[model samples]
Target: MAASTSQHALVSAKSLCAGPSFETRTSKVGFVSVRRCCLGARKLGLVCASNSQSSVMEPAQLPLSPQSGSTPKKSSESALILIRHGESLWNEKNLFTGCVDVPLTPKGVDEAIEAGKRICNIPVDVIYTSSLIRAQMTAMLAMMQHRRKKVPIVVHSESEQSHRWSKIYSEETKKQSIPVITAWQLNERMYGELQGLNKQETADRFGKEQVHEWRRSYDIPPPNGESLEMCAERAVAYFKDQIVPQLVAGKHVMIAAHGNSLRSIIMHLDKLTSQEVISLELSTGIPMLYIFKEGKFIRRGSPAGPSEAGVYAYTRSLAQYRQKLDNMFQ
Candidate 1:
């Protein structure tokens, strides 16, 4: 199949809180309410947790055999996988975690491990992540299950000395390593004054309607923070300027970041309208795949497993490329 002709499919299904007081108990109630609201939104599919839309293209059964005398086509396209970081401390605490750096909770850690297992068979040549520790941690943990079993090294190009010191001398080792690039542009939408606030409390104080508008609306930002639109401006721009080139060069890429930032990127990839983007929820630790071919992105959805028919729909060239890498490790 021509790379451009293949449709993207998202597969796989089945994918927190806080707080305060007039003095004490009020905060706890507020936190519980906030947690319930977030959970309720997910249950109602109001949040962009996972793409529920089915692909028009059906998945072909695996163990694909080459036709006699037919050469497999080399793919000029590459795979792009996007994963939101696992739950953070604030995520579990039901706090308005916009842009506040926090580590993942234990559940979040397990989520990353599962995410890694899901994508282990898919080739990942490069990685992009936000500057936050949660995002960075998720990327590393997920990579732990990669079948390639290569070390993911952070690329330190900030300073001449740092670059020189971080350089790998062995070409063989470099071939087995994936370079991870971190950028603030990929950070979550800054929640502004709401960063550390409990969600339900904020809603109680600011009105549920107002909080909804700030969180779901494309343009309106919370006090002192970036709106989804503002976040898309930088996140999508960075994807185009930095990440897209890598994909164009036929490098399979994986991106680990925050929800809103990934949503902003998805808004661009899926050509979703502002209103449409509001309902596009992404589940934590789930990997959504896209094929960058002929200058367009084809969504392949989330793969249910490594051997799932749609997960690693490689072109002849891609299969060969993977074989070459595997042989190196052998």
Candidate 2:
């Protein structure tokens, strides 16, 4: 992690806010709302608290398997929490949201809160967010709900380097902190020419089917942007090389990024085909949890589904847009 040049500020904030931190009281309201359904057991409480502390303090380590054919050693005790960012400005504008770098709208903020409300239970130790503000905001809000604590998340140098989040977490109650990592591989799909264009207008100019293909196809890149396949190549490479190993070490991981970056990962995790992968939709702000044992991904909670009401609300919530994606399936 790169040290902040303001030796005065970083060092000062570090002193004032640092310690074995706990979630602030305000954050607890949402936490109680979501996890109240399952906290009855004393054993569960101990596991929850212990997982939180251990995941926060320890260095995650996992190695390659010793099988005849080499492969990464699979995680025995890992759970992955994948979250798409809350709705963004472009999402509400009925525009091609590819790589526009927009922040969330006011309603989007509520969606983020609702999202946090939804995933407040799992012991999420580290959060990985895209450098983009919308995703960053989503991660912060979700963590607050998850822990009910307001630990200041300072972006470390390496986190900034990869457009991924990484660094330390200091406890308000203890003298310890944990690090978060960020990477550009988590960035939204980069749309070249169609980035900010109105989806409807683009459809009219180019045949609607062609436009649909651009948005939902795995191999076809729109004028200047990357195809889903391109994004997957980069995203999965990072996941395999950097992120998966962490999960394999029995760590709980939180990934808050854009639609396509996440879809790229989903494609790898679920082993969907190129054609099939394009039809996948990750609802904004919803946390999709997957438990991994051995080398295989274990699905827990919900399967992939259509964008929720909140997601399309950002994308203008148009009937045609909804219908278009509906018809794109295999």
Candidate 3:
């Protein structure tokens, strides 16, 4: 009687735990019934869903190409690193900075220095930054820690006189320098009327949902502000037009810019959905690496250490570049 009572209790517990019933379909291959659970279903090559009534189950068609199974090819010898500028004075003040140029705070300076240390070993042939001082400061500070010890010089291309004055006549000195190009196209999303306001206060004044919509919605802009989509228009265009050619010619590049601007670029790089891009958040000063090869950008994520093994293992070209740098130091 005790054993029977225990068995009944077990069954009752399972019934309670199950919560809901789901219809399952049987497969022809092994007569295995599709599971009601979604966890690990993708790995097992099974896609099943039940109708609202829980009476009918259907198997979703899987892609026939099996492209997911194969490793992507690394056809080009180029790497791209994106770093959002370290915490600005406005960031410390909790102000919506937008296109307002602000300098890095003391902690922000340290963050940039730490960022430089993390990417010290990585090859950076060219540096791109926004017209903002914070971005330019981050770029310069980060380069200061690079193992290459190459000088980061601002490219003065605005006027012929400025270009001539900024020219380095010494070919050797020029070879030892990385061109830092500043573009207005890479600037932060224009925050419009919200630029100088405190974030929490603004949210309290305009409703949290409304403020969130203005800041995060892909297409909707704050009153007179640039939406993320609008920011992507110029940023991604500049990337394709100015940066792609350099990468195609086998150049490793670093871009230091604002959060929203970098998000726009990352959206393009990762081919993220509009919904996916909306949730993407980038930490200040931390550098994210991408292997740009075969016209595809494969994200390697942030390097855990300055070791080549962590990040350079993705591409033979990057490994070779690291070797060249090692030889130079020796």
Candidate 4:
């Protein structure tokens, strides 16, 4: 969907679940282990700590449903978070990882956890990730710091049996679980022959200008590989077809993907020209936020951190949601 230019007010914040006794004010909140809560709750769960706190906030009313395929409503507003996966093993090694599926480095894990804490108070009903392990790991690790404590379960819809086998039997369990959909279309740009190659060595062999063009040019592809424009085709198409419907349905969505794929989506969201997009750079594990309302995407910039006062004040709804968290855990 194309973005709207007219000014629109942010929607009211929805009430999140009340659970856990973790310290939201501390920077160490991201490092807190939820292994016990997760193991006990199951469902690929990572739950927040629980205490004697009682619920004080009522759920926010909405004009539209948050179900998977609900129709779009102009009055509805939802949060859309885009996170580039943290540093992968190949990244640390300075290798071209494109579609190679490397795991995250230890620092990458920390980056993802930190990214989670920054947006823990924000609502996230659904998650979309790339088919790569690095992106998937980042998403799961980040959710561990969420204030809502809902379990994120990977939806296995690729095959009939896979879907049936992964189904939860209890309706209550479904309520506490967020669906994580993985799509190859959201994967990093394919590097073709450059996969597993060291960046410096490739640059030395191919010459710096040629290698730079292959990496940074908007439409020039490396030998037998995809260019930024080519990558944008599939990524933006998937975002429009699969993700926009969720936002339209009022579901809060998070996307964990690679630099190129996410840049492609951001180019679409921000309506950047091909030349502008080629120069865009996304730091690993830093999540960018956009408010989806009235079928338009409004870029709110990257959230600073959970402790930053302005982070909550980005919108009235976000501030209310944080206040509810404070009340629930106080």
lDDT of predicted model 4 = 0.71
Tell me the tens digit of each residue's lDDT in model 1 across 257-295: 988998888777766678767766667887776666656
Scored by CA lDDT, what does every candidate get?
0.67, 0.56, 0.68, 0.71
TM-score of each predicted structure versus truth = 0.74, 0.65, 0.75, 0.79
RMSD of each: 14.6, 18.0, 17.5, 12.7
Q: Give the deviation of candidate 4 from the true structure as CA RMSD.
A: 12.7
Which runs in model 4 stand beyond 4 Å of their true positions? 1-73, 309-313
Q: Candidate 4's error at 133, in angstroms?
A: 0.3
User: Model 4: how far is 153 from its true place, Å?
Assistant: 0.4
Candidate 2: 10-residue stretch with minimal lDDT: 38-47
TM accuracy, model 2: 0.65
Q: Report lDDT (Cα) of residue 95, candidate 2.
A: 85
Cα lDDT of model 1 overall?
0.67
* The candidate that achieves the highest lDDT relative to the unseen native structure: 4
| Model 3 per-residue lDDT at 249 | 51
Q: Tell me the deviation in Å of residue 162 in model 1.
A: 1.4
Best by TM-score: 4
Residue 185 in candidate 3, Cα distance off native in Å: 0.4
Give candidate 3 regions above 4 Å deviation. Answer: 1-75, 307-314
Clashes of each: 18, 30, 0, 4
Better of 1 and 4 by lDDT: 4
